[model samples]
Target: MYKILEKEDIAPGEKLYVLDAPDIARKAKPGQFVIIIIDEKGERIPLTIADFNREKGTITIIVQEVGKSTMQLGNIKKGEGILNVVGPLGIPTHIEKYGTVVCVGGGVGIACIYPIARGMKEAGNRVISILGARTKDFIFWEDKIKTVSDEFYITTDDGSSGKKGFVSDQLKDIIDNKEKIDLVMTIGPAIMMKVVSETTRPFNIKTVVSLNSIMVDGTGMCGSCRVEVDGKTKFACVDGPDFDAHKVNFNLLNDRQKVYLKEEKEAHKKCRLEERISGNK
Candidate 1:
């Protein structure tokens, strides 16, 4: 059991939970994730390692309570324990001074992109970040991302904040106006990443995206998070959660994310009903 050392609400349905996980923290790298199982009977879910403090012996996981396990995990307190927190898993983000790099993130994906952008900045790269959410309230980590980014833009679908459009709009403008961007890194919904990749492809920029594959074990054994990259089968947990965007098969990844829709709905309903019944006292 890993103790929750600290917890902070970063945005609506999103939280930053710092756990006393020395080993994982010390070994963790940008773009990596942890497979969390709320309890023995719970299903495993992979969440990105938003940040870590090696000397402090903590790994920070920013989770959006969008499903049953996450909701269950969120209800627990700082002093509580997470049943399983296995990782620093998958290939870490490849950081180098790739000159000017654009990092795009959408919705809750901002948390995952934050660490990667920070690393890129430390590597002496000029990082530009674009983040978008459905509304202003949905976005988080503005100051944090700003800290590492040489340039930053925020967008909301409803025009409630920064730019009034999708993240791709800002990205398009950047690609059109900015000169000499060598790479682009993005993390979000499969469709969003696909669009971002397509946007950058026209500019002949190298684009990288992290795959949120349906994972059980944070290892190659399960084969649940398989993805076709450059026409070869790759397991996301070990081979990557990150891949060359142009080489990834997005249509399959989109379908794969929906494979457990029915089970997930039932699980959410079960959890809510259980909560209601227990609260009836």
Candidate 2:
């Protein structure tokens, strides 16, 4: 059993869990994720490795309570043990000095991109980060990201914090200002990433994105995480959670993401029902 060493509420409905996984933490790298099961009967959920400390033997995973599996995970507080925690999985980010690189993250995708941005900066790249959310309360890890970034821009639809626009808007501004951006890495909603790809296409800026958000059953045996990249089928679990944004088929990816929405809602309802019953008892 993997024990939870600490838990912090980073944002509403989002919790960061630091787990005691010596082996996994030692081997973990930027852009890899883990498959965790709260209990024996629980379904496996893939969570990106937000951060890891090899010396402390701990790995940090930020969980957003979006569905049954995650909500169940939220209830498992610090000191509790998880039934399974199976990785340092997926391909690590291709980190190298790529001149000025823009790292974009939308909402919870910020957690996934944090480590990547840090690694890029450490590798001698000038990292410019853009973080966006619906409102100010939704944003987290500003200080951490800022520490690794040469320049940082924040955006929100409501203008509650930072600039009042989307991350794509910020990207356009950066490009329009004649900034020499060699590469762009983005992780967020498919729609957001698609927009980012479109924004950079004309400028010929290389963009990398993570498809972990749409993935299910990280073992690749399920084929549920299969996505079309450059008109060819690729599994996110084994092939990559990271891919060139321009070559990715965003239309098919968006469609595949909706495949389980109805079922997911039903599952969340069942979880709520069980919770209420247990509370009453």
- At residue 51, candidate 1 shows an lDDT of 88
lDDT of 2 by residue, 1-281 (tens): 99999999998888999999999999999999999988879888889999999999999999899999998888887898999999999999999988999999999999999999999999999999999999999899999999999999999999999999999999999999999999999998899999999999998999998985466578778788999999999999888989999999999998988898999999999999998989931
- Inter-residue clash pairs, candidate 1: none
**Candidate 1, 1-281: lDDT as tens digits:** 99998999888888889999999999999999988887888778789998899999998888889978989888888899989888879899999999998999998889899999999999999999999999998889899899999999999999999999888989899877867889999999888999998998877899999998899887799788999999999998899988999999999988998999999999999999998988831
Which 10 successive residues of model 2 have the least lDDT summed? 212-221
- Per-candidate TM-scores read 0.97, 0.97
Residue 120 displacement in candidate 1 (angstroms): 0.6
**In model 2, which residue pairs have backbone atoms overlapping below 3 Å?**
none
Number of backbone collisions per candidate: 0, 0
- Highest TM-score model number: 2
Give residue 224's error in model 1 in angstroms.
0.8
